[model samples]
Target: MTTTGAVLRIQLLGPVRAWRDGAETALGPPKQRAVLSLLASRPGDVMGVENIVDAVWGSDVPRTAVNGVHTYVAGLRRALEPGRAGRSSGAVLTSESGGYCLRVDPADVDVTLFHRALHAARRSRGQGEAGAALRLYGQALSYWRGEALSAVPGPFATMERDRLRDLRLTVVEEWAADMLAAGHHAELVTELPAAVSEEPLREKLRWLLILALYRSGRRAHALWLYEETRDLLARELGIEPGADLRTLHEHILTGHPELLAPGAGSPLPVYPGGLPPGTPGPVRLPPVGRDFVGRTEELARLEEVMRGESARGGPTTPVVVVGGTAGVGKTALVLQLAHRLVDRFPDGQLYADLRGADPERGPASAAHALEQLLGGLGVDGARVPADSAARTALYRSLLRGRRVLVVLDDAHSAEQVRPLIPRGPSGVLATSRRYLGELAARDGARLETVGPLTAREGTRLLAMLSGRRLDERGPAAERLVALCGGLPLPLRVVAQWLAANPGAPLGALLEQHPALRTRFGPAEAADGVPTGQFHVIETS
Candidate 1:
């Protein structure tokens, strides 16, 4: 799906609505609205005729179903963009191969906007911006006029209704928690009773409601609410209030000042995922090495992949695969690039080492990696499934609207990082020693080979590491760079040795390591190019 035309606003979260130039443009009939919903649910992805038919008409498809779908597309194109000539290709909804796909900015869809706002709120909360986070969370929740896809009835609507409602409930609880952190206890005291009544089993909501009531000088009401929750749980599931809830009840009974703390400062409800209660920790990008240097082109490629064709819809999920031999600085380069892209992925950054090249341990299973990632995203450990496929599906669902940066280091195969790749504006930077041919050929990964650095780049790296410029020792530094074979890791090691042995000469250090002297003798070897892995093409 591709569009470089006028703005198109399509709302599907609550009711099926389309707007052009801030005016509500009519979207034909029920079938047409269903088609639009199905396509817009997954923008930029082609939906086949059968899937569309199934979603629109279920098993009771008409004999003229194929023709009917074509008619609907034609009608939608005209309704979406009325000026197009007869039989002209649409800029918004394009037909390809077997079916059609909707091309629209994710921000235009209420579902995507809601999710983006939700993540923004989470981030704001993390940064101690409870007021901003509360506003954002409230803006996200406000998108729901009622049950999502409420007006649109079909199998797809039924499926989405349950998913969106659950999400809405979670958002409601999250908003209440943020309000509690922002110290708007009185407001929550008024807002949460009805919500608590709706889902009596939701202990955290009831807890927040109790906290609110207590802080608002309603101690009797707070105790009664807790007792009410305890009785409800016992009556419904034959269990008492959780330990945390019980503890909170006692704290309220004692009139602890801590109970009245800002929602941001209040302890979060414990989730099984080892996350910090409500908010997951900040982007977990490992510290970039101090001595890391010189991957200008590779770093450019990372930026290119992250923002690549966002306007044109170039790659639904852009992936940059950096492949090279051991100690080629692939991981270091990826870390550097990931740190640089922090603002791009505000949802947070995720890193997982596949252990593909570890001698002691085998390559990490995709399922295990998913468990870590899901946990990092604040998913409960018990909530994360055991099956790899299910884990992948859940991971994708979590990543759908959020802009997360995933760094998969030492990946063995494309399959290892495949499920981890975030679709839409999110990106993945995967590094491996082996050339993952399938990634480029089948998975559309932009492959870049990280090779040895130049003689000058190597010298600069050594100087950067040693905390002193080596320009005065130019020829000596050049020889040392050549001697160390321009490989970043070994060169850094050589620099560290030089730093420790202050009195030892640069030449003397190389003379001690015979391998350095041997490789220095051969021009090709000094550049660190293996015979077969990389071929240097030259024309005279």
Candidate 2:
């Protein structure tokens, strides 16, 4: 297919509308718009008829789905390439290998242009040209008019809408951060409140707005806004303001000079990966087990979510809560994920034991956790704040503009985790016995539930840890895996036992140590064991 001289401009950042040669093209019915929406999502990629059907109709597909797609394509072809003659193969929307491909100049598509502008903005920001970055960010964000793909009916449209909306929000936050860094707080004071209203739960937005208000000499209003935000978060999400907001409030209250100084704070950092060699920063991550295995999906998901903050070039911190029953490897999974993401966060990695579920001492207070985190960040113990809120504020202030990964282990509640969340482009990986739903609802945290490994994974872990060819043991290994309930703690303990008792067969080991059997009894064994066969024998 050859490209026509005329350009077809498709806008998917907002309502799925299109224009050809500066003329508005009437996209047909909702389903047809959905077809175009899907095609436009992956502009050059070929979408098979079956794939289109699945995306458009979801599960309730009709027998005539293929024909419906063909009709939609025919309609789109007519609208997109009006000059094409009748009964002719489409020049723009061409059929290829039993699928359809939408060929268009990427610059003509709003989404592509938006991303290009974002890339340029990111580059400018990286080079410390805050003005140029802000201009580029504004240009990129101007493409968004309303909810993306609005009223376009299809599963694909719904998902794409959500994705594009999130991207727009990220760009907006980055733009505001740049604006603030450029000392344009007076302008943002009137503007950011609406954005905050639209995304009330976004702490980054609230943080920027509060900062703008404070810098605009509206310290009282900023303090009032913090109280309002606190009350709102408490009422809606049952949580307190996150570290960033709390820190800003403290600065406002204490009349911190940094808040009032020119060049108030630098723009958020944009490190692609590791910092240069000899960039000294604390690496406090706990060593992960050498025999760590499984949770491939969970780990991948965590990395994706954590990296997504930087990938979007936004100032929002990514907080991920890894939750499950005790002894199910929540902390292990978080530590593994943190170790994997260390290079991505160039500032450093910080770890703290909240001891939320510790038997000897109850959950560590937020103040103590903040002190530990601040000390890990190289803040002297003597200089740490005496007040809890002041400590949280100071901790977040230290984290601002730095790409650090703060791993909060065994968190007791959302409140405990909230004060510890890092600010700016940093990331947080928190493990908790409780679900900590408030983090997700209030902080935009991604909740990942860590569970026991599958039988195959357990067997692999055992084989790796014990230096045993457990695959050779077949049903006995399977029985042991079931008996361990696939939890890492019990499996590691048994693997260690087998490592010590080298030649003991798996069945004989079970017979020889009745205490081991009692501890890791059958999956149905009840006493002290939680549901899902979680023994709760020890802390993760």
Top candidate on TM-score is 2
Which residues of candidate 1, in runs, are more than 4 Å off? Answer: 1-282, 309-315, 467-473, 517-540
TM-score of each: 0.46, 0.49
What are the clashing pairs of model 1? 180-263, 181-262, 181-263, 181-264, 182-263
Q: For model 2, how does the per-residue alpha-carbon lDDT over 1-540 read when each residue is reduced to its tens digit?
A: 128777688988778898887889999999999998888877888999999999999999999999999999999999988889897867788898989999887777788888999999999999999889999998998888888899988888888888887788888899998888787888998888878888888888889888887677554346556766887899999999988788786666445566763654642221111122234667899898777888989889889888877667566688998877666788889898899898899878899999997888999999999878877755656656688876776566556567788999988999888988866788888987777777899888988766788999888888877777466257767776777788888888877888888877667865654565567554433223234665545423
TM-score of model 2 (CA atoms): 0.49
lDDT of 1 by residue, 1-540 (tens): 136567788887777898877778889887888889889888888999888888888888789988888898999998898887778777788888888988888778888888899999999989988789989998998787666776785678778778887788888888988777667877887788877776779888888887777666555445556656766899999999999898886665344556756544554333332233135444768998777778888798667666653334433777888877655678888898888888777767888888887666788988888888877766666666667766665566446555678889888888887878766767788888777878888778888777777787888888877656355258767877766667676677667777777777666765666655443332233124342222121200
- Please, what's the RMSD in Å of model 2? 23.8
